[model samples]
Target: MSIKPLYRSCDSQGASQRSDELRTYAASLIPTLKARAAETARLGYLPSETIQDLEAGGLFGLTTPRKYGGEPVSTRAFLDIVTELGRGDTSVAWVVTLLNVSTWGAATFFGEEAADEVFGGNQPARVAGVLTPRKAVVKKVDGGFLIEEGLWGFNSGIYHANWDMLSIPIVDADGKVLDYGFAMVPKADVEILNDWNVVAIQGSGSSSVAVKNLFVPDSRVTPLSRSIGGDYPSTHLADESLFRTANMPLAALVLTFPALGNGYAALETFIASLPRRGIQYTGYSKQDEAPVTHLQLGEASAKLDAARALLTSHADALDTWAASGQYMPFDDRAKVRRDVGFAEKLIWEAVDLLASASGGSLAAATNPLTKIWQDARMASLHGFVVPNTNFETYGRILCGKEPGTLFI
Candidate 1:
């Protein structure tokens, strides 16, 4: 017996309008990704070939600087790629979101030489990251710091990447550690434990990473003096303003795109069912005939649209600041963060609306919407999108008060 798999595609509406040629290539890979999303969920991680496929699509370098064999796609294009991938598969989308955001850090924090080292000055560069601040502190070694830190949830796009960026804390003999710097270790140095098992986004392979007693040289990690993000790495060759946008919002925004895409995919599923599903109690033959169902679809669709706009608005703000070559002002940065938080809320709401309107079938073990709903909400609790903390922190920043949070 043979069954046709569910082949799908991400919305290319945003990508087609963009000038970047790489997006078209990346967008085309959606069906293959969609085919594997369920298997990824079942296996709790994407198999190696999935990573290889993404690499071939050039997704690993989606945000790499143009100078380093990167397409240096536009912010809109990057968002489009992410949202589309998320639409296809939450786990792949998670990998895309985390990996792209981490590489986005490299463009802004590391210098040209560093960029070249990973991207190889000829092929697209892939960087994996673990930013949860799991560090053992780095002391001054003669040439570099002897970093003995193990980062949890390293999100092994490292399986496809050449460089892995682990967060490290600086410490002196007196035990007063100063500054947060990211250590760049070659994939060869890090050990991956296939430990990513949880309620959602199973294919992310967000396993524990052990870097035991491994040494990272000074040139490997860039010293981000403070969370006060601004232009630093100065890859003068990558003069694209999008590549230079404020590091904070870029990293923060990526964390939410998968949720946005998942919500959209869920909505799409509901829409597909409406044309065929018969109402349970009424003689009505179509789910869409019910006013409540129509309202649910309309409300959920509107929320998704709003979420899209807010996320893009944040990206637009970052684009403006980077183009002007000004540090993204704290106030603007805070607002952009608020937008990210709001976007998260919107996606979660969309999921709830769609799931409720979908009826108990959404609760079925074999139904995909249940997975989408579960994944979207669970991922929203991710540190970057926690609305209460993001709202409070951004609100404080907006009110001219000293903001307290390591995130921005």
Candidate 2:
């Protein structure tokens, strides 16, 4: 059977209009998100109301194909919406970001039949995925491979997802490994393990998923190597730029937007409380009146602005390459990863500085500053945003050496 292509040409004006609508919708959800932030953390999962709002707003379909009732907005629009959501609550933003990117992957990497099953009839599908393979056993069968068993950790948004994309090793009948790829499975096919107890971003519901003797058809599988290099299986839609964008760096870059929002929120939270807060040992009745406070605030703000600039530049570069219908160069792709890590590092540094100047009381659980700090710290520690690995990868590329990591 021939796979149908889902391609629709979008003019510049239509794309811009859709982006504006998405931005407005995302902005409308911020107040609700902020109101529910504490409750989400307390419950270790997002509120049902928040999930409903996100579904109604189409926030989970940011990168999904428009032909499937998805928006397919510009990269800038996607980042803007994610950052705004993050400003309200990092955990919520983290979940939405992962869901949107995974949805995009489902549309781009899977066959048309799989896409129809997931995104047909304007249905809103929340997909959570993790690409790191662990203890996965694949055996060749007649029509597909039987996923004997596998466990994937850090399945963010799994609590709300109906579908899951898991990375697994492809094996031959003789038990010889062939290539690493993804398995698209219904959430009911796997078991969710409640083990995501963390001190930060606790509401993300990043649990582990386990599958046993599940059969994944060939149509639902895509090689990780091909997807990373922009060689997607949905080649019938080759005219669309969204499907052409590099996958690995896109995944890495999206994680930083939420951290940016958290950083901005930290700055806003600290500055807003400055008027009533006072130095513990100093005679200054108002912290805002102190000269040291001014210096710290200014430094943190500048750092945050720098991080924003870097994020914007990298996003623009990705869009440019995609629009031109060309493959992103290895160096440029590496730089995107580097930029994401650097931006995350800057955000964490800014948050730490602001938290330090906010005084010891900022550490109290009742204070929002404490949560913001913890969230930023957790976001910075993500495997994709780890500063040292990205920096080394970019540095190696700059020095005429191959990037040490395969993700780029």
Candidate 3:
């Protein structure tokens, strides 16, 4: 009962366990990720080969357009990859999920020329970005906007990305802000600063970028509002309905999976470790034989199930809407918000329960459970998953209160 069963169960061929074609590819990569995860955290950057393997595994282009030699996979498939990666190294998973989301966002919003340019020569290029358009300088240029600014807290695949998306406000000649555009900048045009030392999520390499007088072409920039409004650059080529869905929902999807993975990781570790780790000074035959331990495991897994349900339900809804080519209304979007909030909350519940059950062994620096506890705590602090804040926002919608944000 010394926590070995949990690891074996994860590797078993149970259909419910995390073992499918995508998960297998992801699981096979765990040895490399686990080997480098600590180094990534200590050095504040991921090795180039780690990035290469991820791309070779087809992780970076999870949602890329199929027309561009990409898979354009489902959102659930994307989450499963994150989950498998998170099981071995939460930091790597954190970085992959965020970078891929930015990549997918770019493919969904940017024009055909832009998609080909980014994902064309590069088979699995990571897209690093920050979506908050703050303190930016933008002016109209020959063919696009001239932007010279830096983005902070940019996470996931920063060192590995060939292109970056910086959130900037496009200003007209009159100095009036025209629109909030996600400006894609080539890696050479921007400089990365290795200033990503943090408390919990240390391995993300969440560095800052510095740029001066970088001219981004019109094709590379996408107006976020228009992308959500159904007027996207991909309208001419692929179906623009991908962008027709709510931006808030898409944003929430990107945020939910990493934490969910961490929660699932904690549950799996606890369950696996339970068989060997007996209670201190208590004569329980084995931790697994104890009635109390069984209760805790069930409770922890139930919380994980709730979180997964929230994510899959929202993904199914969005997929249905995208397939139907229908413009989703506020009501449908509100459901997405509700689902995202519930999933995030459920992650904390699972993490809290599993961490409590893990006891002192889980607190060790080298233990996977330790990282899961820290990562889950940090994930809750993310802006999108701050518990009651989103719940209150969703509650207001149910009570006939108009959403205050433009996303819904």
What Cα-based lDDT does every candidate model obtain?
0.72, 0.83, 0.71
Candidate 2 local Cα displacement, residue 26, angstroms:
2.1
Tens digits of per-residue lDDT, candidate 2, 84-135, equal 7887899999999998889888888887888888776444777889989667
lDDT of 3 at 320: 62
Q: Report the number of backbone clashes for model 2.
A: 0
Q: Estimate each model's TM-score.
A: 0.89, 0.94, 0.88
- Any idea what lDDT model 3 has? 0.71
Clashing residue pair totals per candidate (backbone < 3 A): 0, 0, 9
User: Model 3 TM-score?
Assistant: 0.88
lDDT by residue for model 3 (170-223), tens: 777776987787888877787777777686678887787777778888888888
lDDT of 2 at 114: 82
